[model samples]
Target: MSGNKIVAIIIVGLVHLLVGYALVTGLAYSATKKIIERVTTVDIDEPEPEKTEEPPPPPPDEAPPPPIVAPPPPININVAPPPVTVVDRPPPPAPVIPIARPAPPAPPAPPPAVSKARGVEPKGQSRWAARIQENYPARAVRSGTEGTVGVSVTVGPDGKVAACRVSSSSGSDVLDEAACDGMQRYARFDPALDDAGNPTSASWSTRIVYKLN
Candidate 1:
């Protein structure tokens, strides 16, 4: 190639390098300007306004009532009492009249009655009398129950217990029945004596008290 063409080529290459360098420098300067803008920003604080205080209200117009109090008692008086008259009293009244005590009421009157019929009171002592005593029934003795039975007996002319019955119940049926049985088998008496002193049949009620000592 010709010398002038080679020179022209070299000049063109130098011109393009110069243009690239200038463009890169311009971009870097723009980026630097943006960073400076972001870093330089500062925020300022504003002052607060002063507060005002409110005052208390004034007192009421009316006044309160006074406390109650009692008045003093009237001054004590010093007056004198009226005079008393004195007359002689008769020598202390004649000794009080003696009171007469009425005679004690008559003793209670004797009740009206007729004399009892005479029947033989059996000779109190007898061999059979002891046997008639209540024998505690087996069941009654075990149960701790005891009582008295009243018996009316009939004595034959022969002076033996002819019959007997329980005139009054001994609370326990066992005791009452036993009493009758005992009397019939064991009770015998000497014929009772009459006003004439003769033997005769008679009945007597006897109570056998059964108790454990």
Candidate 2:
């Protein structure tokens, strides 16, 4: 099958042919035979083939998985805020709406109105002017207290002083009280007249002044 094997086989065949020709050419048969047997029988040892180390087998193949790609971020959208609820509360119950009632009807026939005009005020007698200085109190004169005292005198229809009161202060109680006492004791009046010219009770205001001199 191989070139070396074919060449060795051809060489062995040529050696056999030479041996047969020698036999046919009348060569020493036994000697030749002995020589052939010795040549053929001689056992020559073949050298052992050199041992070489075999390479290790390759590892199994594994392909890597494909890379993962994340999706892009979502876009920002502008949105308006929720509207505020107004919730208008009812207006304070209309402030108690008090209905105004009409005033009572006046009396059909009224009484006759009395006249307020005074025809004349009461007049003091001529001696009334001299009675004031005569009535000065001893205590008030000694203390040197001097002031003007106003008094209101009520005169009755009989032309007599009925009541007297101090209407204004003279800064000294002593002088004020003396003034009223003197008027009641010595004063007289012509009674006042009303609109119908009738004598009536009336009040008059007068003042008394005191001095150290």
Cα TM-score per model? 0.39, 0.42
Q: Any runs in candidate 1 off by more than 4 Å, and if so which?
A: 1-118, 123-129, 193-198
Q: What is residue 75's positional error in candidate 1, in angstroms?
A: 99
Instruction: Put down candidate 1 lDDT per residue, 1-213, tens digits, no spaces.
Output: 999999999999999999999999999999999999988876767888889787878878777788777888888688677897787874566667888999999999899755443553555435555655536678888888788889898887677778888898879998888888887777666667565566667887888766655
**Cα RMSD for candidates in order:** 19.5, 35.8
lDDT of each: 0.77, 0.81
What are the per-residue Cα lDDT tens digits for candidate 2 across 139-161? Answer: 98888889999999888888777
TM-score attained by model 2: 0.42
Candidate 1 lDDT at 151 equals: 86
- Number of the top lDDT candidate: 2
Clash number for model 2? 0
Name model 2 segments beyond 4 Å from true. Answer: 1-126
